[model samples]
Target: MEENQINELVHSFITYDYNNLSINTEELDDGKFFSIATIEKNLGKQIFTPNFEAEFKLIKAISHPEIKKI
Candidate 1:
């Protein structure tokens, strides 16, 4: 990833197998979007890593309080 790259975190709706999960991000400043580059079985493992986990937590933290939690 480059210094100008901004990775938006996705909040998976989270079913038993992540089958019903949705990966998305709000329309960015330039109308660009990004989500976690995750594989189904590896979803959990990916989110557990320091980098992705922290970014996800940060996303949740900065999100509007009323619209948080899915």
Candidate 2:
């Protein structure tokens, strides 16, 4: 994040233990005001795959042109 620019952070997980993995903050080219992360789920031993596509999609859908407190 840049100076004086508050970045909206994002991370997703299946549980508080974080058995599923959380994504790192990646600034998307779509806009500077928004960011993205890809969460991974553990299906089985040593198996990891994308898990929060729907949630991320909803986030993307709800992104605002300007920030607001609620």
- Candidate 2 lDDT over 1-70, as tens digits, reads 6689654444532222444544445744432222232222222333222333545445445655331111
lDDT of 1 by residue, 2-65 (tens): 9997666544322234455443446333322233343223446653545556655666567756
Question: In model 2, which runs have C-alpha deviations exceeding 4 angstroms?
Answer: 1-51, 66-70
Please list the residue runs of candidate 1 whose C-alpha ends up more than 4 Å from where it truly belongs after superposition: 1-44, 47-49, 65-67
Q: If candidate 1 were superposed on the true structure by all CA atoms, what would the RMSD be?
A: 9.9
TM-score: model 2 vs. ground truth: 0.24
Residue 18 of model 2, lDDT score: 45
TM-score of model 1 vs. true structure: 0.29
Local distance difference test, per candidate? 0.46, 0.37
Error of 2 at 38 (Å): 7.3
Tally clashing residue pairs in candidate 1: 0
| Clash totals, every prediction | 0, 0
Please report how far candidate 2 places residue 41 from its true position, in Å: 18
